[model samples]
Target: MTDQKFDIIVYGASSFVGQIMTRYMHEQFADESISWAIAGRSKSKLETLSKDIGLSDIEILVADASDESALKMMCERGKVVISTVGPYALYGDTLVKVCAESGTHYCDLTGEPQWIRKMQDRYESVAQKTGALIVHCCGFDSIPSDLGVHFLQQHALKKFGQTCSQINMRVAKLKGGASGGTIASIINMVKEAAGDAELRRQLKDPYSLCPPDHSFSARQRDVKMAYDEEYDSWIAPFVMAAINTRVVHRSNAMTGNNYGTDFLYEEAMVTGKDGRGKRMARATAWGMNAFMVGLAIPPVRWLLENHILPKPGEGPSEKEQLEGEYDLRFFGKTSAGDKIKCRVTGDRDPGYGSTAKMLAQAAACLAQDVPEGAVGGFWTPASILGDKLIERLREHAGLTFDLE
Candidate 1:
């Protein structure tokens, strides 16, 4: 293996979220005795971003996704690579492959389930053999959900002598907007599923992301409105549930079903406290269903994507990010009926600001804290980083993990 020149490399540093992540690293961790660099396909753009973000002297590397040699060379220099580029299925496959083969750790913010499954199928064995920890969904889409479940299970075992057999994740409060990359990823996901039957089948499977022979056959909530009697509130389908639930299940599989062989989990947006809340929940649910249907139609999808959706590299302003916030609560119950509830909350917006910080810390945790002989393979953040990441995020990323 080539000599490691950097502890972490922020690949795709020219992308919107990429710039945020690199800037965060410079601002927060520059003096922490870790070597890092900003890299992407364009040297000039990287240089400009560095100057704009007051990181003018930061090391910069250029490597396009299409160039295997350049990517491999880039992979050789960094012990851990943080990739912010996505619809990762399109541009991230090569970098992940290079990292696995080169024994370099890797992390990304991809919420694409089918693509993640594809990566696991092709590279998990190689990464395990080479000691490369390949972790995905480190950002808002899955981190809070995955890690929240992890934290809850730990507490469950400590308090009840067993892991939770069920977890119900509720979005208690959220105020955030989407970025262009996220919109594009969702659009691409729908388009890809439109033609591929197997992909559609996989997308529908709750066990799609879990390892074989550990599939949990339990009821799950889809995109439909319902009342959550436990919360005494009306609830609507959460958009991120499809991706986040899969990541949580993968964590369970990675941990050898430590959570439980019959674990059941579902996610929803808790609308309100009373009858008014129930009315709003029904409307929200129907609206989401309509939106999904509209996205599937060619004309509606074209108009919405072209006219309303943000284009690539576009995002909210710094002020908006600062004002954004989210709170996710997970309620768990053991087979004996004992219960506990915990929360994961972020100070900044979910899609960009908080995500940038979470991704940066995840990369740092892998680069600096992952113990030797950890047996690298396809992993979720909770499965590999666990409490180490929870601590980093709480200390530096403006996140809180609390029992309620």
Candidate 2:
């Protein structure tokens, strides 16, 4: 490869989550050998951010999302590009295309299933051919879920002589607020699927991210609010399961079903262990379900977009972010009936503080630690970064993965 301007270019470094991610990389990689820079649509904002964060020496590149030529140029300059600009369905389409064609690695914090499906269909082959590893949902929405499964299965194989035939991820604890950009993506997803029957179908498919030839033998659960005899707690469907489950399944598909062809997975939040807990779980689940349906309604969506929810470039305060934390528990059952458990926890808020660090470390892992001979294609975190990223998260991102 020709000498590039930097090792990685953070493409949306002026936005809320983007700002956190840039500041994070700046502090963490402060005397490191890695070369990196920040880029965004506003040169002045990028300059101001550089000074505010005390990284004025780092170069800033200006490029609008719609400018394909500029995006392609940006892609060519960085070995990897970290994009935080979202409701990706609106802003990410062209950038992924340019990155795929330019043979540049890309990662984004997108949780929109329909848009991801479209990108996979349109760019998977091109990305594979051009040696670009495009990965998505490398954030709180899925990384903990994806990599938790990965960590569990590895230990399951070692202890049980086989991978898990089924895995369940429980969001045991989480203290964080969602980013406005994340809220926008959810609203856009609801709106897009409401009008497109095919998109709706894909959204509901557990194996939507799997290839056409893929088949499974395990029976997946119909994710919903329910009582769990195992944990003795009331469990509610996780809002992020719709996205994280697909990423986990995609990891299995991309890895040639390394976990197993019949592998099954589920994700949910655990309430408490009594009747009141069950009531609360059902209430929370049904409330979120209704909220999703409401967002699908034009009037409700308009009200939320205009009045209720925070807009893009807005999110929780630094105090709230620093106070955020999450704990996930994974239960795995091997084909032989052997069982194992694992946990993944984060010290920062799940949505902003943790997500920003996870995305940055994911990009850094790809740029520095990917195995030789790994080709580019649409990939999930478990299938691409795996242990290297797990290590990075633990060492630098306030994330820990431990087997129980």
Give per-candidate clash totals: 0, 0
Please give, for residues 1-404, the per-residue lDDT of candidate 1 as tens digits. 35658999999989989988887888887686778888899999998898888885688889998788999999889999999878898888999899999999999999899889899999989998999999999999899999999999999999999999999999999987777887788888888898999999999998899887775777665746777878888888888999999999889988988987678989999989788888888888888788778888999999989998898788889899999999998999999999999999999989999999999999999999997679979999999999999999999999999998
lDDT of 1 at 402: 93
Clashing pairs in 2: none
Tens digits of lDDT, candidate 2, 1-404? 33565778999999899999988999888986678989989999999999999995798888999999989778878999999999899999999999999889999999988888899999999999999999999999789999999999888878878899899888899898767888898888887788889888887788888776788656678667888877779899888888999999989988889988878899889999888888989898899988988898899889989998988888879999999999999988888888899999999999899999999999998899989999889989999899899998999999999988
| TM-score of candidate 2 to 2 decimals | 0.97
Q: Pick the candidate with the highest TM-score.
A: 2
